[model samples]
Target: MSRFRYSFQKIVDLKTNEKTQAEWILSSAVNDLRVEEDQLSDLKHHKSEVQETLVSAAANRTTVSELMLYQKYLDHIDHQILNKNAAVRAAQINVEDKQSNLTAKMREEKVWSKAREKAKLHFTAALLKKDQEALDEMSVSRHKQPS
Candidate 1:
């Protein structure tokens, strides 16, 4: 019923809203990391299949010129696959790092959020007290009048 109590209630409500927002953001980051990891795994599998194809090509060679040309093409393809796979792995790692950073930020936000709520409640209480003191002084001056 007191002004301080009402102010503290409002502070609690605001903090709850902020916590819900933080949770939603963190959950989205986790989902993105999971999807990136899946893509990285698929890239690794593709690289293995490409290596197998090149090995088979080498074994089926007939003439020197034909074998050399076939090998050159396979080598080029293998190089490309290797580069692409590396990039996928790097991207996956970056996604994981982003997820971790988001988690840490969420925790820090929770801590700071509680402090923010407390400060808001305290400020409201101080304002209420100042207003009450002003009203009391006015009442005393009115009562001491020579009416």
Candidate 2:
């Protein structure tokens, strides 16, 4: 009997590779989003600490210039936090896109895999049938011969 060969093995491999690449892209985007979120958290923590210091200084009769400087610094940190939030949002979107692409590639690969499995089953059935026929012929020949 002839060996079973999958006709679309190459296509399956290609789709698997594409899925791997998309997974990598998604991982990178997720990592980037995490980093941006961490930075934003740190900035917010620092702003709170500065605010507390400013309140203590005001109670201790701090100069107007110093108070103004602290307020300006707080505003700057707020702006940075806003920008970081936007960056995190953009990274999230990128990860979602990559995830979608990976899903598509995986689905394509599964289709080819199913086709290969069907072909193998058909080949096996044919081989079994051929073997059964050969056995039947040999048995009939033996019975026809002299006992």
* Number of the top-ranking candidate, with TM-score as the measure: 2
Worst 10 residues of 2 by lDDT: 1-10
lDDT measured at residue 36 in model 2 versus the true structure, 0 to 100 = 83
User: How do the residues 1-147 of candidate 2 rate in per-residue lDDT, one tens digit apiece?
Assistant: 688877878887887788788888888888988888898899889989999998998899889999999999989988998998898888888888888988888888788888888989998999999999999999999999998
The 0-to-1 C-alpha lDDT of every candidate, in the order given, reads 0.67, 0.88
lDDT, model 1, position 44: 62
Residue 117 deviation, candidate 2, in Å? 1.2
- TM for candidate 1 is 0.47
| Runs with alpha carbons beyond 4 Å of true place in candidate 2 | none
Return the TM-score for each candidate structure.
0.47, 0.91
List the lowest-lDDT window of 10 residues for candidate 1: 1-10
Residues 59-143 of candidate 1 have per-residue lDDT tens digits of 8855677667766765776676676667667666765766676666667667666776687788788888988999999999999
Q: Which model scores highest in lDDT?
A: 2
List candidate 1 stretches off by more than 4 Å. 1-64
